[model samples]
Target: MDFDPPSNFSPELMMRDAAAYRPLFYDPNTTFYNGHDDQHPRRFNEEVTNDWYDFLDGKLTREQIAAFMLEGKKVAAIANSSSPKVKAFERFVRLAHQVDNYACTPINPWSYYNNPQSDTPQKTSEELVEEAIRDYRAETNAFLKNRYAFQALKALFYAGNRDAFERFFGEVEPNMPRNTLYYRALGYRAGFYIEVKDFCNANLLYAEVFNHVPAMRPVAATSLTLQDEKQWEQCLRAASPEQKTALWALLAFRTGDNDRAIRSIYQIRPKDPLLSLLVIRFINENEGRRWSLIGPPTKDADPKANHMKEIPRETFDLIRRIASEEKTENPFLWYAAAGYITSWSGDYDGANSLYDKAAGQMKAGNKEAADQLRLLRLVNALSRITEVKGDNVERLTEELRWLYKQNSYPGYGEGGMRYKTAIEQSATYLSTLYAKAGRPELAEMLDHSSEKIAQPGVVDKLIAVLENPRTPMEKLIVDMYPYTAEEFYFYKALQALHADQLIEAEALMKKAGKQGMTELYTNPFNDYILDPLDAHTRKHIKEAKVKYTPITLIQKMREGEAKIARGEEVYNNSLLVGNAFYNMSFYGTSDIWRVPLLNASIFELVPCYAQEMVMTSPAAKKYYRMALKAATTDEQRAKAVFLSIKCDRNDCYLGPIRGRALCDDQRYMNQSNSPNWLDRDGFGELMRYANTQYYRDVIRECGYFQLYVAKHKR
Candidate 1:
């Protein structure tokens, strides 16, 4: 008899194997391009490869990718399914994390609306009904012989045509052979019965299907859940041999019969994807004690934490064995889930081995999805380091950095957003670790990297860094994000503010704000209008309409390329130049861009450079200032005062990159080391502002302010 390796088995080989799959020099910005690769070759053809690269690089829009995939799916049905084109099509969809074949029902004819108009031809009620019936017939005709005929029948039921649906459903039942069509049709009819609340017929049909088709037992179980407890119990009692054991396992778990549930789960063989998932769910629920991490608690007052407790070694092995036996399109997820359980159970080495296996399997199939696998592996590795695991910290951090590089590389496809949540979580954990271990620089670096999916925890970290008196003003003022020129300028302003160079700060702030607003603040009049306009309005339409303008250096470069491509000379133009006379104000700067009060407030909370913006029109600031002065209500006055102070504080403290740095120059993650007079938290300063009773009276909604007030009460 063979026994499993002990929990403390060496994971060095597994770690090394996992690291080998990661691409060298992975950077999201520079990996993929529009043309075919000569140096770094791919297995796919030119068009397919280009499309993949374009999709990954953010060049291909979501709509374009969707349309391409849809067309490919349609063509694959009629064309030689085994052709390279079809394979490419299938691979493309998989790369984008979409299914090649989708189960989509036709739209109901009743969903269409006929607009009433004097000039439009109108049909009689009988003709209208006849038209709807004809359309429905055509729709059913198209899908009847198709694999999704059952879905078409279900569509009829959804449109409230119960009589027609029943008639057609019955007609299709007897002729339906024991194939995918037969299974699907039976499932749909059973679902229809459930929808009509005919529990007896639904249960009878469910029992028949569950008994005959082992594959659809999972679908049947989902439907069974909607029934009353008595009805479900009756169905379970009448379940066929194939489904009886699964249903028993489910019922046992539901009723807290742990031993029976575990036994039933173990007895289950491979190839039962749904049952396997159910077993996994049972294990997770028991292991979590409450599946709060999976989602919010069902009860309002329920605790929101994962209370992890190690199960018996036998139980753990059983679950792992079940996951290993799974033979599905994506068993890697099950493997990863098992790994998560092991890690949570304090078996770190066991978890690493499991992760390594999952990553290996996923990489063998689809290289694109392997990024997600790597992300999971790295996250688990980070989770294992509780009290700074010596060399493991640097190793894990390097792996995380590699993961970031892969996610950022344009060659990876449009997965940055998809993988962002995991990446951010890992970054947050690593940052927190670094901060606690007396590595503020690394902590701050990781903290900045985690901003894409940054939470309130990120704000807390920023507050901590700023509050640390030992942290140099230069370090704190470092450009946390320098991806964009606008951000760079804004960051520099913060640095200037820290250095007490108010003039430079004000100028930089203005420049940064202008850059941010120029791109984001588009003209409202660009979209189509609803109706005819008055003569006066029509006369002003030409002046009101404005074209899109490029503001930042990147935008300017793109626009210039398009213009040059159109045979237009764009360089050496005096019209594009700005002549600034800056030594004028009390801050020693000329007229400059300043962030709007609303944007300033938002940036203070979120702290991303892209969130920084100036007033689009100079008059808007004057108008807003006038509005502030005209305010009479306490709430209005309080908000205005806070906004003013926030803007002033930001102008004085926030700065951009000044010297060489370890990180990239992207505005999104830039951070400076400089310190400023105002705290990054700004709570104390705000509390001071709200010192007056009237200010305090209207600040009830602001929780931050409330907390500050509570901490420093008179």
Candidate 2:
């Protein structure tokens, strides 16, 4: 029933740096936040190191502090420590970065609202990414603080410092936006490889990015030629915007299969300069020589303004004239003739029709040169249409959408900003369509629209739709209830959705995407209820040997009711949910099989009630201690505090905290810790109770958490 966020959510937000949260040089007046601020500028005055050490008072034990200090010796062995302070810092980090500390809870967006606001804007996602990149660039210097290490490591990897990259990879936060940055880096790497005449590896990376940012592409041949690389031409063809477009154009031209490419370019908004640039490049490249200002001038513009140098008036007009067409057309002629064209962007189906007619025209004994000229004219006409900016957007929206969807529209070609514009236009069109259609429901359990909810016995109808086989009704229902995984209950909803219920019937048909007024029968129903269990018992299931049976999924979750509970923060779940699964598989693939599904099962199954303890309660205590030891470069003391607390606890339980909980022990991040928090944060056994009990208070608020805890009693 909920609405998805508009697709226009800027990717930059995900890139901001997290180090900005730390106080800038201990300004007590403004210092509300004090986590790892890697971006903190180097100190200006005499170092007031003691101020940091003061913050750790009372929370961490002496033993833990010593353990944290001793741990840094390993890091010191690899990279030259900036100062003795590094060893002291690592000692505390070792203790803090325990597997026990890692387990506890998933992130709760709602909890953020309760916390005191910091004066700082907090790091934007992009800034964080930049910080990571910046870290990568610096070849020397071990990370002084635990908080900023992950970001710096990411930067090192991006900078291609192999030593820093490997070290950082070993310690990266498993859930950091690895894909986002990785793709960009990979794209650059691919381009680099192409430049060096390494076509095979270059293509592999290019193909990888293209898959995620689907409908995405390459670099210039000039550098390759300058380097005297043997495959300079192939690299240029692979990376250059102009060459890539022509290749696609030629592919479409020869085989008449331009659906994918045409659709991709057509998706680009009309005003995008890259679109014009692509056109200009296509023109010059197709002719085997550059042309005078066909569109925008090819001079560099201000990066901030992203200005498009004006095309010559004569060129603009010539293209404009060709754009005013309704006939089926081919756009390549537009480039040959320096004019615009109507019709689609050489879509295979549309281009096939025009290609036949052009062939017939040549068969009539037309002059060979004249026929070639006419053929060029067709290319001009179609290309011009792609170039033309439409009037009255409302009237032209559908046409523009069709145009945007065309293969050769040049929207997503390899130019700098083209893909963005294409993404923007396609997203806008999608938003408009959704608004017009009235927030189309996923046709699971209807809870949003008044019309859907108001019908007689509506809840029942919603239940029947949940039972459908085509859709993931069980999963959907489980999500809606936020309860344990047992498949009973919702009986009232099922009975109501039975045959002869028109409203529910309509909903069922809607799930199936059907238009019907006839047979208003209810969906089939099955019973799955049993007497509720009275006690918890460990009846090991499958290979993992986990599950609290007899207790049922619902009852187990009640065991870990948060001593204090924070409300759920409903961030978009599907993608993040997938990401967690990806991380799990990333860790468990070779080391453990059933990784994706196993991680997915746990991610979805947990009510995440332990968020309070795992993130805020115990973990926060250690974080303050690290900041304190960092004051006099006392890495030794910090390690003791971490080990005292972390060693006694199983780190496997703290995965969510390590992933998103902002723990002091972030230095342990890597592919290995994805499935288990203990592996990420905890050392041995520090907690006084079972791992689940330590965070049990937070888990109880969730019916699902209670079910899991009770059901999975070991």
Candidate 3:
């Protein structure tokens, strides 16, 4: 009955404005650290387009440039103007293309390991490398020179001329402006350091790139590698305060030890925006680990201290201290995060107080933040409700409606708010409360499942409400009920049929409408008792000539019962009724009848149904006994005895209590409680007709009977 929330935190709501960093947080599309591929490329394209616009002095429109760069349109075709700026832009674009041809091709790190014969990269020619170097030497304009230097560095690095790459980097890096292009060149040098196995220098360079280049931060962080503590310390020692913060950010991402990273970055720069991302990630991870409000209480003596053990003491203190200081860029973020942690730890009062403060600090018209605060407030309200009765339900109706609305239409709220966790958690909380309030029908409706609905009386209560919902709570339950009235009627019919209430079952089946016409692939009154485990029996049942819908089958059984009542062909009528009951069971071909009724698999019906109704086949056994009493010949009597014994054998194997002692295959037939029905009087009567074709058929087909006779003879 435990219901764990899908997730308790909405990273999209928290970081909607921080689009560059959004991919770094929890995304349903990708695992942690495995970010969205488009984030970096999108940022890179935006920055590059801006730089290109400025470089061309707006000679070509931004739209034209975007189409040229992103849509693979030729630059010459987009910029047909003969101005010097456009001409210079053309040269720059050509050099950029040459550099990108080598740089942008994806390098599969596991190519050699995964496929030894994987194709190698197409090499950049020496002539192209030399031409890039010449372009850098000739360019005098600072912007054009930086662009040329980047191309030259990329070309040399990709050309496998490590000596030339280092020589050119040493000459050009000092004069290069610390912009995205400069960071791009620096990233190449860092890759070289990693190639040379000097992880310390490589990590240091990557940290610098991470700190300076916002568009390339993901790439830099992914590339930064500290093989051991020695290299980590070496990088930290050589890094500036900003670079050190970037290194800590990478550490937080690589290892989920965000508390240390947040503190380390906060110590270096209290106002660092990275602190917000790290703190939000930390809070979200904790939220996922926190216990549900209705889950098992913690070991703490106080009933209110349910999830106190889930929150890390140190991290909680750190978040509280930071929120109190209000130093981070998003003070509202810190306060809201702190409030959520407090709420999860069972301090509803303290949590609401912080939430109020967070609301006060939140920027007006910030819908995402406003929605987050409202959700938290709702959670606090829901957590405080110890009982679900008239007063509490009335008081929280609006909030509950809002929560349900958000879940029903995800785009209705501040879009992409992670409400799945809250929705599932609230359902569990409300369902548990309703159960305690002696309203289990409402509980089952809120947390509807085949297993819960299959519990006795749940369906009857559902049927009552569906028939006439007088109360507001009943109407609400009806609104939230997942299945239609027809399905409920069909389910009721199934239960009735299980209990041998044929008249009620027929009435309910009539109310089931078109659902009652769902066809069974095989005959329900087929005299051959099917073993579900037997391949041949399954094939034979699949190829059965007779097909009957639920209504038709029930009507047929009713007709047979009427014939039995009139004592006309009483033995045949009894046998037909018995076969119908038997085939409707878990072991029989017509178990497919329950598939649509329960919305469960044919395989799952046995476990999903009440064990006694299915496992014992009591109705079928009763009818078989009636058949034995009316039988006029040894063949008829023998058939009745054998079919009844099949029911007893099934009961031994499947009955919840009797099944336990008889389950061991090695001790199956020898068990003290095992039903050796073949040794009983009916079986003795069947044996008296040993020469009959019916008895011969039973002996040939029934393996258990053969084993029993063999044991008795021994």
Steric clashes per prediction: 44, 126, 0
Better candidate by lDDT, 2 or 3: 3
| Candidate 3: residue 293 lDDT (0-100) | 41
Give model 2's TM-score versus the native structure.
0.22
- Please tell me which predicted candidate would have the highest lDDT against the true structure: 3
In order, the Cα lDDT scores of the candidates are: 0.43, 0.31, 0.74
- Lowest lDDT 10-mer window, candidate 3? 655-664
Off by over 4 Å in 1: 1-174, 178-201, 204-234, 241-269, 279-318, 324-333, 356-365, 368-373, 387-390, 406-418, 449-714
Per-prediction TM-score, please? 0.41, 0.22, 0.73
Candidate 1 yields a Cα-based lDDT of: 0.43
Q: Write the per-residue lDDT of candidate 2 for residues 86-136, one digit (tens) a residue.
A: 444443344323311222123455656776353222222344445544444
Question: For candidate 1, lDDT tens digit of each residue in 501-540?
Answer: 4455656656665543453232221211111123532332
- Where is the poorest 10-residue window by lDDT in model 1? 574-583
Q: How accurate is candidate 2 locally (lDDT)?
A: 0.31
Error of 1 at 254 (Å): 10
Candidate 1 has a TM-score of 0.41
